[model samples]
Target: MSDTNAIGLHQGSASDLAAKLNELLANYQIFYMNVRGYHWNVKGPNFFELHEKFEEFYTDLLVKVDEVAERILTLGHKPVHAYSDYTTLSRIQEDKDVHDGEACVRGVLSGFQTLIEFQREILSVASDADDEGTASQISDYIREQEKTVWMLGAYLG
Candidate 1:
C-alpha cells in the first residue's frame, strides 16, 4: 500500500508541495539578504527613510522565510538551509553593495514581483493537493506582497 502523511496527502503530492515550498523559501532567503544589503548600504538624500524601509522589508521577509521552512517540514520534507541551495534554487539574484536608493527600491520591487509570481504558482499546486495550510499561507503572502508592490511603486514615482 502507498503511504500518505498525517494530513492524508500522498507522499508524491507532499513531495511536490515540499519542493515548491523549498524554492519559495530559497527565494525569500536571498531576497532577505539583498534587502539587508540595501538597508546597510543605501545612500543619497533619502537615506534615513529608505534604510528604515529596507530594514522593515528584510525583517518581514525573514519571518516568511522561517514560515516557509516550517511549512516544508510540516509536509514531511527537510527545508534547504544552505546559502548555496538558495543561490541555486532561487530565481532572485544576489545583490551586492547597492547604494543608490532608487536602485535599491527597484531591486526590492523586482524581488517582490518574483516572489509574488512564484507564490501564485505554489498556491495553485497546494490548492490542487488540498493543502489548505500552504494555500492559505501563500494567499496571505500574495495579498500582502501586492500591497507592498503598490506602495513601493508609489515611492518610486
Candidate 2:
C-alpha cells in the first residue's frame, strides 16, 4: 500500500522467490503490451481475422496483468512497474516493427506459450511455498494464457 518498499513479508522473506514472482509479473506486462502492438499493427490478407483475434488476446492479457500484479502485492511484494525494472526482471521481449504476418503470429504465439510456462512454474512455486492465494491466481492466469494461445494458433491453421 505504501511505496516504502514492498518486500520482506510472506514469500518476500524468501527474496529469491519473491524476485522470481516479480520477474514473471514484469514479463506479463511486456507480453500484454506486445499483444496490444499485434492488435494495432497486424495487417495482411488475414487482416480481419488476425485483427480481431489479437484484440481478444491483448484485452485478456491486459486484465491478467492486473490480476498478476495484484497477486504479487497480496503476497507482500511490490508489483514491478519501472521499465528498467521490467527489462531486468521480464523474460519477454517486445516486438517493435514486426511486419510479416506469420512472424507476428509466431511472435505472439511464442509469447503466450512463454507466459503460460512461466505462470505454471510460478504457480508450482507458490504451491510448494503453501501460498494458496498466489497459486490460485497464477493458475487462473495460466488457463487464460492457454486459451488465448489456442485461439491465436487456431487462426494460423
By TM-score, the best candidate is 1
Q: What is the C-alpha RMSD of each candidate to the true structure, in Å?
A: 0.8, 4.1
lDDT per residue as tens, model 2, 13-42 = 344456767888788788878877877887
TM-score of each: 0.97, 0.83
Q: Per-residue lDDT for 31 in model 1?
A: 95
Query: Which candidate number maximizes lDDT?
Result: 1
lDDT (Cα, tens digit) per residue for candidate 1, span 27-66: 9999999999999999999999999989999999999988
What lDDT is obtained when candidate 1 is compared to the true structure? Answer: 0.94
